[model samples]
Target: MVSLRAIVEDETTLLNALSLTIPEREELASITHPAQRIEWLACRLAVRRLVEAQGVPYAGLQKDEFGKPHLIDSPWHISLSHTTGWAAAVLHRSRPVGIDIEPIRDQFRRVVPRVLSDKEITHAASDLNRLAVYWCAKEALYKLYGKRQLTFRDHLHIEPFADHEDQLVGHVRLPDHEEQLMIRCFRTGPGLLAVAY
Candidate 1:
């Protein structure tokens, strides 16, 4: 099973509404910017709500050497992403998961050479929405892989899919390992959310 949630809230409101553990508060202290602090806290609150909804107590989170977030004492795997005003998270019962949320922007066109392959660029066809999907899909895949030194244009690949298609297939091609994963994408308000597992 997979559970996902996204929320938009200002820093002051998030600070007032959510309670934090001592460790969580200590972690928050290291983030000096108000915007980043809000994103951090909001993602945690969203994850806590989703876990508690499943009758599991929220035990906070820990990160691995690769910086992948894990439920401290639970069986679920989690991934988090935030952009501007939005924060998003995903929890999976038996497998590693990745989630990313991004707003569509014109910048997607400029990064085509760096972020997409020939076929992916052709599939996008200079369309901002399609480029956004490719970007988010690759980002989700990168987070799922949870390692370093992989490039979107080289290591991660997304199979062609229409703008209206909600599902996608992604490939991770490393010298030592290869993987195929399922990805799902959907519009969320002014942005798109992608989840890979």
Candidate 2:
């Protein structure tokens, strides 16, 4: 099983407290933008706590160009996700991984045409759950790509699936990389779908 942990900070104040507990808190706290600072703190704290729990050092954490986190010195692969008042990270000693959590809403449907192929939209149009599966699948791909300048529709493609809310099949169609990605979706709360790859 994949090792995953989630922390929900109901308020900005609580999130700030968690951020200040990280060793790199001072450096991140210096960031001028509030959003950036909070994100930085959340990512650092989550990774650090995970590493420490596993009896590892903070130096093991590393960031890639796309800001994907990896373990430089440890044997674990890691993925991170966050939303309004929640932050989550997963670590595993084997297998590349990706995680994403999104607040479920009809807004996702409006954007579906922009990110999904005509075939995909035709398949998912009737079902809200299926649409969310597609959204989360593409999002997982985006997190894996860890780079900018990717068009969700043109560059990423997810195979059409039946109207099932629990799972979906995704395919990444980038020029040099084409991989079948499996996506598992869960309702973490009233209007949220959390996916992992």
Candidate 3:
């Protein structure tokens, strides 16, 4: 089973404890991008804490060329997500896994037409809502594919859904595989839109 949780602090004690738990913690800590550094550390901390309670060791984690995290010698699969002050991860013993979280914003409108197909945009219950769903779903699919050549519009497609204020459903279509994805959108704080995949 996989669990998700939100970390609200940037304390070193928590970060160090997480580094000690995950096998690839040292590697993640080496990341220098300010945003990446914070998220990588926070996510590592959350995943380690969750798996350790189940008797899993942090040293069992590894990452791919795209920097997606996975279990080292163990067979379990893992995925990480972080947005602003929050971080989350999922662990499953079977199947390849991917997860993403984003802070939603109006800026998505500027990029929506580039990624969404005409059919998808038409099906969007509202213009703003459509773009938000499209952005998050594409991000999730990108994380799953774990490759650089894929373009959100040319390579990925998402089906539109009836928009509610807080949740939406869509299907992510890739060149090789198609899967249904669920996106939950809500305000996490002032001026922040959060999407979890």
In the range 102-196, model 1's lDDT, one tens digit per residue, is 98999999999999999998999999999999999999999998998799999999999966899999999999999999999988844899999
Give all TM-scores, in the order shown. Answer: 0.91, 0.75, 0.74
- Lowest summed lDDT across 10 adjacent residues in model 1 is found at 1-10
Candidate 1: clashing pairs of residues: none
If the candidates were sorted by their TM-score against the true structure, best first, what order would they fall in? 1, 2, 3
Off by over 4 Å in 2: 1-40, 193-196
Q: RMSD, each candidate, Å?
A: 2.0, 3.9, 3.8
Residue-by-residue lDDT tens digits, candidate 2, 1-197: 22233444333754554524353445556678766555555655676677778777666455676667676677677777766555656665666667777677788778886888888888886577777777777887677656676788888777766554567666667677777767776667434444446
On lDDT, the stronger of 2 and 3 is: 2
**lDDT by candidate, in order shown:** 0.86, 0.65, 0.62
| lDDT of candidate 3 at residue 25, scale 0 to 100 | 54
Query: Which pairs of residues collide in candidate 2?
Result: none
Given candidate 1, what's the lDDT at residue 74? Answer: 94
Per-residue lDDT of 50 in model 3: 64
